[model samples]
Target: MKEEKMRFPLSPKANPQAVITGEHYRFTVLTPKLIRLEYAENGMFEDRATQTVLNRAFPVPAFRKLENDVSLEIITEAFHLHYLKKGPFSPNALFIEVKSNFTNYKNRGRRLADLANEF
Candidate 1:
């Protein structure tokens, strides 16, 4: 049997409601299954890094607009993502919340070992 490889396009159309563009970064909702986050040091045309985070692995996500367009809710099969835009107090903060059926437990043994492996 041949193993199929999944491919995600680097550029995709942004959802008008959830899209935000800044001088150094561009954030957009590409599709119900994925969201694209891009950053450029100089500008979008130079020295850029792009990454697409999966929102729904199987079923498509449902997007919900929150109060006064301050927050957005992305409901997926695997997880729920809550995105909060920067506010008056936090002018440069981007907050994200991931709700899933998993607990994040820090491994003390792996902490030092992982740091050493980096070198």
Candidate 2:
């Protein structure tokens, strides 16, 4: 059987999560091992770095009326990402929810969601 080699967003060694579809943004895992990445749908970027997350919505899709962008949620130690669609109060909008680490970040007093939000 052929082993499937996954493609990292950037230099799997440096910024594996540095993927981009046009001007959209990507997330980078600062953690050591288990480094993976994913891309955020256009129009969604939540800057949770400081305090609030900013949603970048634009274009409105013209026909489908998509007025929101996607956001990248990175779960630390889980080695994965969730692609959240653009929408308000969308339970399914949660892009990616990866548990790279079987154990949550509670041990570190932080959370993977917060890390991805900052990215």
Please tell me which predicted candidate would have the highest lDDT against the true structure: 1
lDDT of 1 by residue, 1-119 (tens): 99999976443343356554554555455455455555556545321333533232223235553333344344544334443433211212332344443557521223322333333
Determine which window of 10 residues in candidate 2 has minimal summed lDDT. Answer: 58-67
Candidate 1: segments with Cα more than 4 A from true spot: 1-11, 45-96, 106-119
Give the C-alpha lDDT of model 1. Answer: 0.41
| Top candidate when judged by TM-score against the true structure | 1
* Candidate 2 off by > 4 Å: 1-25, 32-77, 84-90, 100-119
Candidate 2 whole-model C-alpha lDDT, 0 to 1: 0.35
